[model samples]
Target: MAVLSKQVAVPKSGFSPIPVIDMSDPESKHALVKACEDFGFFKVINHGISAELVSVLEHETVEFFSLPKSEKTLVAGYPFGYGNSKIGRNGDVGWVEYLLMNANLDSGSGPLFPSLLKSPGTFRNALEEYTISVRKMTCDVLEMIIDGLGIKPRNTLSKLVSDQNTDSILRLNHYPPCPLINKKTNCGKNVIGFGEHTDPQIISVLRSNNTSGLQINLTDGSWVSVPPDHSSFFFNVGDSLQVRLIS
Candidate 1:
């Protein structure tokens, strides 16, 4: 009988520091390069998305999600996709509502992506700001990644990405408490936050702390913990980025 494979890596405390790089330091660049190579993931503290902005985004996310299920379902076009997407057991959605926004570099108006984005101020303003700020951070991070890869500093991380030069999207998600104490994959227990799958996004800039729902699959048949850090965004190259890099 074939069974699904699942393993979760709970983080061990020892780690390289969550970096806040100074572009001015020659050595700063080198350290960043090493961090990426050693672990495809790292936390960026002092990354400067103002507290006010963060607060705005957080407040709005809650306000938006709390609306009537019908209101949320208004923009629900994609599968389970109002403004939210249900990640495959491998995608990230099991029992969670998340924001899926695009910073359309190809499309002129950011609102060109969908109707939901333009609806009202609560979801509109914060998402717009979040999309912009996040993309800026993503663009800077990609350049650093290029440098770390020893490529020309101006190398295009994703060619034909867009005229805007970069397009960043957002996936804001929420995982309600799971009612499982001794939760193991299929070990006869009722526990779930999400199924299991690797992230397919190029970069992940999440805003979360301590609820501990996200996990990554390692090649060794184990799931690793995505350490929750509210202040810093977590970055990991997606399947798209990996494919581009490998090719």
Candidate 2:
């Protein structure tokens, strides 16, 4: 759900400070290429998904996470349904809980929704609508990326990523507020909402509530905060995509 990258400098000659691109612009293709090559991540605006839909999705997400723990546990299955940090055997734990669903149902071999959610028309409808919209946007961006890379036959990348049998997993993450912060107690133990790690998918699109916890490492070995903007989505080029592009 979150993508973290290690230090890799933007070459001095063509560095873009913000790495945001308006997909509607005529020159966005060139900008996309530069963003991928220089930063490996970028923010996208004018992506055709309605703001109202995004708001609805955010609200529904909060509602889902607000459900009673027992209710959520009905779908508690590793890598497929709802899960908490405790699911992992390692002693280390994070302050996050998540729900995972396949964005494209046709591509998924198993049931699209956990049994508890299947009967709720409202929840299912909202999630399905949001997933469809996101899938379209993701495909659109992938096409642009391929074009920007000058891949002969624009559909090459599209076909590779859009296989009807491959499901794109959508992970809804909720990072709970740390109680220790309010007490101001020095527990001497670090609390991480989500650990730092790179995404392994071809690409990852992330939208977060307007709180600034996301950080990416810089070439100078320092971490830089990525300011949260509720109005846009952050796009991360995953290792697979980078490999495909370069090869």
Best by TM-score: 2
Clashes of each: 10, 0
Q: For each candidate, give its TM-score against the true structure.
A: 0.71, 0.84
Whole-model Cα lDDT per candidate?
0.54, 0.71
- Runs in model 1 lying further than 4 Å from the true structure: 1-26, 79-93, 105-119, 153-155, 158-162, 165-167, 177-190, 243-247
In angstroms, give how far residue 197 of model 2 lies from its true place: 0.3
Q: How many clashing pairs does model 2 include? A: 0
Which predicted model would earn the best lDDT? 2
How far off is residue 127 in model 1, in Å?
Answer: 2.0
